[model samples]
Target chain A: MSGPIDFYFDFASPYGYFAAGAIDALGARYQRTVNWHAIVLDANFQSLERIRIPSSVMRSDYIRRDVERVASFMKLPYKAPSSLGLHTELAARLFYWFNDRDPQQSRAFAQAVFKAYFVEDRNIAQLEVLQQLCCPLQMTPDDVASVAGDSATRARLKAEIDMAEARGVFGSPFFIVEGERFWGNDRLPLLERWLDAGTY
Target chain B: MSGPIDFYFDFASPYGYFAAGAIDALGARYQRTVNWHAIVLDANFQSLERIRIPSSVMRSDYIRRDVERVASFMKLPYKAPSSLGLHTELAARLFYWFNDRDPQQSRAFAQAVFKAYFVEDRNIAQLEVLQQLCCPLQMTPDDVASVAGDSATRARLKAEIDMAEARGVFGSPFFIVEGERFWGNDRLPLLERWLDAGTY
Candidate 1:
């Protein structure tokens, strides 16, 4: 039996963006299908009382260092997000909506949003920017807006966050292969090794 | 001025115990003092929602494999902790008390504790085991208990935890050399290199 790899992601997280692209490559290389579970990280943080405190100067610095470390390792161009934080809930839900229709399109949408914020330093919170992001994916701005406004989609997003919390998921770019959750993107190589072993 | 290495630690963390011993050796090797800060990991989990779950069945299966990988890489024993979970708050505070009295004694105590829990499979939570552990050091059981119970020590412990939370300490065995926090015991050599560079 081939064990499936579940990719949990949030577009706002640079790590998530990195994992989305890399996991896709890994899936192709290993002949494994990645089941994408797009999740809103903000809601998860709020539910866990994991607030982003403004006074946490060291906290921000650590994130900067981590981003640099990961980017350097991955050979990806990364600058700390210019906006304080991306409103990931809307973006994740939109990805989920698109994934339901076309998974490849969802991947493109995730990448575009990441590039919009990380590469271009654009404010993703602005609706116009999000609408503009959808154009590249051939997803109508109205359709994207419509999906973003769906109460059911929002509820599904919440369910995704709840499921992650229930499963003891603590961080983004979490990979669950055969019910085992690897919390960090750095563990992807380890996850791949496990897949190759064919033990589980 | 040689700035102190802010040692971020969680009392209940075994890796913290490992780092504590190695940090002392590193300090002696480099002629520096490590400013140890006791941080409550439970508080970090609450704030960050990063809870430690056991490795997956497959991941667990891969433990022996990875242990060998890490052991060969670091040239250190990579045994898993005996007890599934340990309460480190009291042990941490006791460590502070011991350190305040004598650094040598504290280092011995830390090493003993690590060996007991990680190597010998002893339950560190049991007072009887702790008393036996303390006996070799000639630490009066009553005095040790009193120190563990001191309100001032408890308050100081909480304050230190608060400081760690503010400083963005996410995991155990975190070392800060010249204001840089390096997470994980594996990062100690890298920390030593940075210290040698003497760039603050």
Candidate 2:
């Protein structure tokens, strides 16, 4: 229970964005480190042969109303992006790229990407938006292009996806500590309790 | 805000069963009445043409693990039934049947049915099991058979489904307070806050 927490999420997930704000703070309070693993939701399900998440948020009205109210309830800044099917793999690739060099900066970059797409209504699928996001963090466009063009980054993401598959991670905002699995943003209270008591 | 809370849920949903224990207490604390509408998840999605919840809990390992932890987290008694796709419509019919005469008894019967399946590992789909559940409530076998034999109860369930469709309900453990929709058992906290503050 005192062990480090592992977070597995897809960048396209809104709940993942919402959870990004609180996860680090929770880890800090508990004095445990959080390990962020970026995986694609599409890849996770395609492997399981379970239901495929719709490529567009426009396909599900329930998700639209649910996330909007959730943002309001969670007091997080949120605006619906025109398209949800953006460059999740690219964002994740860049995350691993930054993550290898400086994990702290990678966390910052992840937050920026979430904010850009969710709050600012920017299309992160495009390279320019990601480059603009990277600029503030001292990452040059060449750095992004290098990662994008590299087949090695593609292999890195595949390894992450393979790791997720090994762990049976089926949803976003998944948490694992001491072999206990908790899924979805709503389960955080339970995860927090486990962290508090060292067992539930 | 002081208006009655509408709860839409499917009996097959373990979270819905977990939620049943607390919703009444929440409503009573706020001096609000809870109107429980027993919905079948299968029908809800068939109408919407969305993803169908796997008929059997055995079909999905993830849901199985998720609900077991949730039951522990919520401190509710739960035993996985041998089969899940049984008698949801029958249970809904019986609830409405009693609701028309004695709402209190109907609530009690609803609780008993939930316990029979989730806590006792009994099948509510069996007439004998439901009848055994009814005995303590002073409802006789004739009363149960009469409803089962009647086409009226089938129509009654259809009406409930139609109403759910009109309300845009698509999941179990759905709550609507004055047109604000909250989905999932995890969302009860947010729903309670809305009740507490009158608006969030």
Query: Which has the greatest lDDT?
Result: 2
B1-200 in candidate 1: lDDT tens per residue? 45667777665565565576678678777778867665657543445423232323213433334444444344445466545457777776777777777877876787777677766778876766777788898988887788778997787777777677666566676776666767777566557766777632
The TM-scores, one per candidate, come to: 0.67, 0.94
User: What are the runs in model 1 whose C-alpha is more than 4 Å off?
Assistant: A43-61, A150-170, A196-200, B1-6, B18-105, B118-128, B135-171, B184-200
For every candidate, what is the interface RMSD in angstroms? 9.0, 3.3
lDDT of 2 at A156: 90
Q: Write the per-residue lDDT of candidate 2 for residues B1-200, one digit (tens) a residue.
A: 49899988777778889999889989999999999888876653454635344454335776777788788888888888887756587888888888888888888988998898888889887787878888898989888978866899878888888888778777788898988777788888888888998876
Question: Given candidate 1, what's the lDDT at residue A172?
Answer: 70
DockQ of each: 0.11, 0.46
For candidate 2, lDDT tens digit of each residue in A1-200? Answer: 48999998788888888888789989899999999988887753454635234455334776777788778888899999887756588888899998998989989999999999899989877788889999988989998888877999989988988887777776788898888887777788888988998886
TM-score for candidate 2 (chain B): 0.92
Chain A vs. true chain A, TM-score per model, equals: 0.86, 0.92
Pull out the clashing pairs in model 1: B12-B88
TM-score of 1: 0.67
